[model samples]
Target: MSGADIANVCNEAALIAARHNEESVKLHDFEQAIERVIAGLEKKNKLLSPEEKKVVAYHEAGHAICGWYLEHADPLLKVSIVPRGQGALGYAQYLPPDIFLYTTKKLMDRMTMALGGRVSEELHFSSVTSGF
Candidate 1:
């Protein structure tokens, strides 16, 4: 779906939630909505191939490894290459402790950690793959 379509759906969901006497929609509610949308999309049989799965595994591994290496970053909870209900080929789930605030350095470090996978792929494979 397009960004506009997602935005429209989110707006509608917010309206619906509000009409139900919800003071404010939480992040988890929006996340669940997104997951439902993705599940619907996957039911249409749009799944990634083996190569794509490998790339995702590598990408997620990068995130896991980076997070594992950082002291303040979240701990790696799990990493999987198996396709889930939402059609994600892979994912790196983290267990983040309470994050009250973020500093500039912390933000930059997070950004760098996210980029670790792409950088690792480029450095080792010498050929970058697009699905990431």
Candidate 2:
């Protein structure tokens, strides 16, 4: 995250805590702020068919699984199938490693991890959707 992003997250977290009538910011507040920053706002009103939900679950899981297995991939943080942003069916979050420079192998691992979702869809459904 950038310096500005960190400031925004802290500010947002405080707001969330205030909304909940808490005297001080807590882990939950920061978590929500991080999610809001990373995933945009959650669109609770966005509707998905049962099939779509199922597909999204698998697709996100694919990303999580790939990251889990890749030595150079960032550590997986959380995976969600909730509809968020304009058209994201789901997302898999990762906690990027603290490194000043990345090796070529590291970059390749990241690419492989990113493609896991599309490959997963092909494997599971025998076809790929637009995938948001």
Candidate 3:
């Protein structure tokens, strides 16, 4: 990793250890630090009604479920609804292969994966959120 990346991860690890009142950081702390730095901290103060929380949960679940069934979409790593990066309410993390070229089917699979969230909202709630 680059210098800045190392610094951020170390700082986050320290924060994680401190949060747990531990004297040393662990592997999972570093892992969580990377996620925290990438996704920003969870919106602790953001108040969502029970229904809204359910929607966000289902929205994230939809992405995972749809991507899981797709043949050519990137392999999903994680999904969350902690509201990271500007207006992002949630996200799906995919592990795309390192390549410079793409096939048409791969592109379409990506499209289907991307649309999964919106489709899920429409199907479940009979309406889509403005965020999707």
What's every prediction's RMSD, in angstroms?
A: 8.2, 1.4, 2.0
Report the C-alpha lDDT of model 3 over 13-37, residue by residue, as the tens digit.
Answer: 9999999999899998998998887
Best by lDDT: 2
Tens digits of per-residue lDDT for model 2 on 35-57? Answer: 98888899989889998898898
- What is the TM-score ranking, best to worst? 2, 3, 1
> TM-score for each prediction?
0.55, 0.91, 0.85
lDDT agreement of model 3 with the native:
0.84
Predicted candidate 1 versus true structure: per-residue lDDT over 1-132, tens digit per residue: 589869956975686567668888767556545544543323335466776766777777787888878765767766656555544555666665577798777777677777877875776565876533
Q: Once model 3 is optimally superposed onto the true structure by TM-score, how far is the C-alpha of residue 72 displaced, in angstroms?
A: 1.1
TM-score of 2: 0.91
The per-candidate count of clashes, in order, stands at 0, 0, 0
- On TM-score, the stronger of 1 and 3 is 3
Error of 2 at 47 (Å): 0.7
| Better lDDT candidate (2, 3) | 2
Q: Is candidate 1 or candidate 3 better by lDDT?
A: 3
